[model samples]
Every structure is written in structure tokens, then in C-alpha cells.
Target: KLVDYWSDPDRMKQSYRNAVNKAKNKVTTHQGSKSFAQGRHEFVEMKAIQDESSAKTIPPMKDRGILDEVLKSINRYCTQEQFEDLKRQHALEIEEKRKAFESQQKVLKKFVNLFNRQQGTPSSQF
Candidate 1:
């Protein structure tokens, strides 16, 4: 019978408390690990985007025909004006992303500073 399992009130309370603590610990650990992994992934993606942008080298005007030929091959239906507009839009998007990333980095830095100050210890020291 179920009564046989929980015949003692004190034992039942202790068991309940133990179960609650275990659940809390599991949830806390899971959340902390998940947040750490997500932050790492975001950092890696941001760095890769920044690296690709920085490594871009604009070809000389004389060699620009190669770029045009490649673009033409891929977009035979697109007009020259449309292609130029596309390039402009792509550049604008990249610039906007860079600005947004910079803003996020600034906010993250401020949060980290406040967190460290509240904890009363430098993160590097830890």
C-alpha cells in the first residue's frame, strides 16, 4: 500500500526536501551550462563575420571585369543597375550588422563590469 511507503511523516518530509533540492540543482546547472554554450557560439560567429569582412580586398578597377563576369554568370537576368543596387544593399547590410554587433559588445561589456563589481572580484582573478 502507498501508506506503507510513507508511514513516517518526518521521513516523508525529508524525502520531499531532498527531491526539491535535487530538482533545483539540476535546473540551475542546466541553465548555467546552456547560457555558457550559447555565449561561446555567439562569440565565435561574431569573430568569424568580423574576420571575413576585414580580410575582404577590393579588386583593382582593371580587374573589376572578372567580378562583373562572375556576377553576370550567376545573375544573367539581372540588369547592371539592379546588380549595382544589390551590391549597395549588401554593403549597407554588412555595415548595419557591424554597428549592431559593436553596440551589443558595448552593452555586454557594461553588464560584465557591473556583474564583476557586484561580485567584488575581477573575473580574471577567478
Candidate 2:
């Protein structure tokens, strides 16, 4: 009977949905697991990277199976109202790159200033 129960397509679907929901915990729409999301994001990011010589300006990335199972689980198990309450979390990853660039500029500026000062100094060994 237990085997027959799971063998039923509808029952199997329901069981799978239940399991997915349990894993999702209270998540409504966003990522289920942080580590899972991070790993998937990294994979997507790597795949999205464009060749240096490519004319494309921006790396394309969207709904790239990063949360396919979670989204499907939500659609199957979650109420529309509850799902609507869930929001995707987005971090400002670009800020880090921009900050690094700014620091490099500061270092370059200091080096240039020192170079100019040395250039202005007369040769002492003459």
C-alpha cells in the first residue's frame, strides 16, 4: 500500500511538494538556502562572463535556474498571498569593485605626486 501510494502520480507530486516546502522552511519567493543560492549564483556568474574581445557590453543573466526548484515549489505549494510576501534579496556587490577601483586611483595619485616631487628635485650627485 505504501508503494502504491507513492506510485500514484498525484500523491507523488504532493509528497515531493511537501518535501520541497519543508526544505524551503518559511521562504515564500526568495532563495531557500543561503549556501545553495551562493553556489548557484557563482555558477551563473561564471557562465555569464563574456569574452574580453566580445562586443557585448553587459554580461547577461536572468532566471538562470538559480532558484528553479524553489520557484516551482512555491508555485505548487504556496498560496499566492504568501508568495507575494516573499521578496528577493539583492546585495550591492558592485560597491566592492567600485571601492577597490577608488583605492587604486588613490594609490596611483600618490605615486604620481611622489614622482612629480622627485622630478622637480635637482640632481644631487651632479
> What is the TM-score of each predicted model, taking all chains together?
0.38, 0.27
Q: Quick one: best lDDT, which candidate?
A: 1
Best by TM-score: 1
lDDT of each: 0.67, 0.59
Stretches of candidate 1 above 4 Å error?
1-76, 123-126
Worst 10 residues of 1 by lDDT: 58-67
lDDT of 1 by residue, 22-110 (tens): 77753233334456557466556555545554666533332234334422346357767768999999999999999999999999988
Q: lDDT of candidate 1 vs native?
A: 0.67
Candidate 2, which segments miss by more than 4 Å at Cα?
A: 1-91, 121-126
List RMSD in Å for every model shown: 29.1, 18.0
C-alpha positional error of residue 100 in candidate 1 after TM-score superposition, expressed in Å: 0.6
Error of 1 at 53 (Å): 43
